[model samples]
Target: MDKQAALHHFKEHHFTPLLESELDKLEAKFHRCQAGLISDFKQSFRDLCAYILSMQQQGLKEPIGYIHYSFLRTQMLEQSYLYMVEAYSAEWYEDDSDCKLTYDASWAYAPMSAMLENLEQQRKIYMGAINSADVERLILESAPFFHSFVDSLVRLAIAESVQSPEYQAIHKAERLLIRTGEYRDISENLYVWDQEPLRADEVFEQLMQSSEEEPYVYENLKSLSLPHLHQFQKDLRYNDFSYSDLRGSQFHTCILLGTRWQQANVEGGSFQGCLLSDTDFRYCHLKGVNFSEASGRVDRENGLRTPGLCGIRFEHANLDEADFTNVHSFEHAYFEGASMQGTRVPRIYQQHWKLSDSQRESIVWTE
Candidate 1:
């Protein structure tokens, strides 16, 4: 087509609105991609934290565990980019539209790859300077640098002045959406430190304060882990984890005498070999929570029974050899998969228990 003929067609079809509309669509898609990238990155970080916690639980602490993690953030960010923006970039460029315009929208995201690479290099440099054997500290300190990635990843690959005012405005809004509380600032929540992390005592105080403000502190108690606390310390005894979300939290083998876990979501957590004497776990969610070898207020040898687990509902909970000797009213507590061999209960509500033959065989009910 001749230039004159093409110009005429463009003017006749009112191509200006069509172009603007397509640009708006591109902007909207960018936001979706941007949000997805942040989401994926955050989820991956959480999984990493969970994995590290699991290792710590096994009494495995190695210095330079930091070396392994130093390589993750940048790789994870690149993966996020591929999923969020790169996959659709080429598709959008080749799109057949009424305006017959071909847009390499991906060009606006090209600078991000270089930026991520630079970040990785810089991270390696920072990681090298650390002389400490503390793996947690190494990981924690390296984390704040990546917080900027959440803000910078969504920036346009083009020069700001070259962009149209509308494109700039759209980009601004998308960036602001994440910077605001809705997406959550990583430093404020995930890293949760200014220069250094809070001490165990400080974390406890912070959690207790947060508990009072919120109805139930759901899933935000990730910082409550106390690796430094020893079994002999008993420092966190009588801690108030009641009415909080403790799903998947680990308190295995800790001395938690008289701690209140009432109504807390303690599902999938471990209390193996824990001293849970007089702990108020009434109505708490204990599904999949490991209580193997846990002891309560009752000590049949010492005659220290104090009506433990009175009115407690352990329906369907497998108490594998959990010492409930003389626990008052726990005769009514659920003991579905428990091997009650040698474990004694009142047997008062034994008739009301609904158990499979396997379950019944498992529970060696003693009066």
Candidate 2:
């Protein structure tokens, strides 16, 4: 489908009205506080949290829902901080001296604190499934609001001398959100290699010139042997690297989605923090390969329902510190002679696969 048509489909079918409804509710609550109709800040905060959770649960049911919900959640969080900054007065902080804000003789700090934590937890859960372009779009859409919100918060905190624990926590949360957005941008733009063929000497020159900050793309390099190469943080997605010798290659934080490494020799390669979801590594030599913090799982229940590590091989491989969280049918993958020391395999594998005692001992359960 064309780009416009695809976008329309997404907005119509996947993006639900429920998101906008919840956002409207939250905004109305904030407006009510501004009008001084709500004296109990804690009750308003509780209602805001309830709306956020309701939106999150709806997103958990589908991929498109999750994307829309994520964007709206960020906006709501910023709004919540804005409301708190506006509701409490400078005299309120000075009078307490204990950094606690109260309304109607009740502490009003716990709900806001809990809301920030819940937002972060949800972000982490859905991050791996999020598309790179979607992340960029969300960041762009929310940039203006986020900037203004932070500016206002900083000004308010300085004006009121609000160095309370709650203020500090909000500051930290804002910083984390900004940092995570930067990381997402970096991850999205890490692959930029030409798709042309060249002589062996030319290829070697390109590889040598590449660095982790500016990674070279080998997406079109098929059936070629590239052993002991330092192609760290490269974008090798949707390529056919089948029958290639890629032993000891550095692929840290690389994107390898839908890439074919079938029957390839990838021994001792480091794929730390790499995106390997839907990647085909069938019959490949993964001996001593490190997949630490690498994600190969699809959102099966909500998205495409793709199987993780399907038909992949780990014959005599070192899987130390590898994480297989949310991986589907991972037990179906071949693991003959593989070392799973310190590996974080998913619980689904244990219940489905009849693993040997030695194999069980090698793996560490996440739960």
Candidate 3:
């Protein structure tokens, strides 16, 4: 169609609304067209490109008074842009380089510059994904960028998890814990490289020695071998650790969903403000573990869940009025406001409780 005719048709058909209605379709079509740049699809590409440019030019600001959501679309658009470029690279033909490229036929940069920009963006996203919400999606979108991005994410996650407001008190309260002193049981050479303990100064020294702060260095140390690192690819997703010993470790506000802690010794550990849903702590030792503010020790007026035993083992431990809901065990467990539902404890421990048969059945074999 001629330009005048096309313009007339656009106006006549309510083009802007039509385009907006099919924005997703247009996006897909443009992505496919840009990849291959087939001659027949050029017009469709041009129209779509024009619409995006027009929208950008109109300066669409976010909703009124939202600090967080303003940055929300940034990550989404970034992810879309990455996929778009990757598609462009896969379908780009050399002969088309001489001609200006367009999805909507509006003028954009040259093909070479576009490719360069894509590479630059890929690098920037690789670096930024360390502390980004789109880290998971970005990792999935660009598997090639994994080596650079993964470690940064893992370290950042670890660092964030281990640093919380309750860290100081928890750490101080946990000093009475005696180390097994088994001398490095984990096969991953956790003690091999420089063997620097992860104190603040030590970590700072290591970080300063490197020009850039890359989190992968910690990942490498955690896994020592390529095979182990590869295992981490799947394992890292849910922090998938089952029947593991995570004792004396400090975890801050971290994600620990779907992790297995069966029969594990997490003694003297601190898990402040961390998400621990769907985690299995069956038969695990939680002695002297400071679950501060997490165990419902605070009063009900504080609007917190009441302490109820849940899926946790508390053998020979002191849980002074800490919250315990849906906990696993209270076998031989000691506490003040903490008693048992299905807890199998000694008669002396439950001397305070007047239990019915069903409530009594919750405990298997109490002392």
**Poorest 10 consecutive residues of model 2 by lDDT?**
61-70
lDDT of 3 at 76: 30
Q: Is candidate 2 or candidate 3 better by TM-score?
A: 2
Top candidate when judged by TM-score against the true structure:
2
Cα shift from native, residue 337, model 2 (Å): 10
lDDT (10s digit) by residue, model 2, range 238-341: 45566677888877777666566657777777777777764656557665566666765544232122333122445444565556655543443556666677
Model 2: residues with Cα > 4 Å off, grouped in runs? 1-201, 204-219, 297-349, 352-367
Report the CA-based lDDT of candidate 2 relative to the real structure: 0.43
- Residue-level lDDT tens digits of model 1 in 197-260: 3355776554444422232221222223443222221334435454556666666556655455
Scored by lDDT, model 1 comes in at 0.37
The lDDT per prediction is 0.37, 0.43, 0.29
> TM-score for model 1?
0.27
Q: lDDT (0-100) at residue 29 of candidate 2?
A: 41
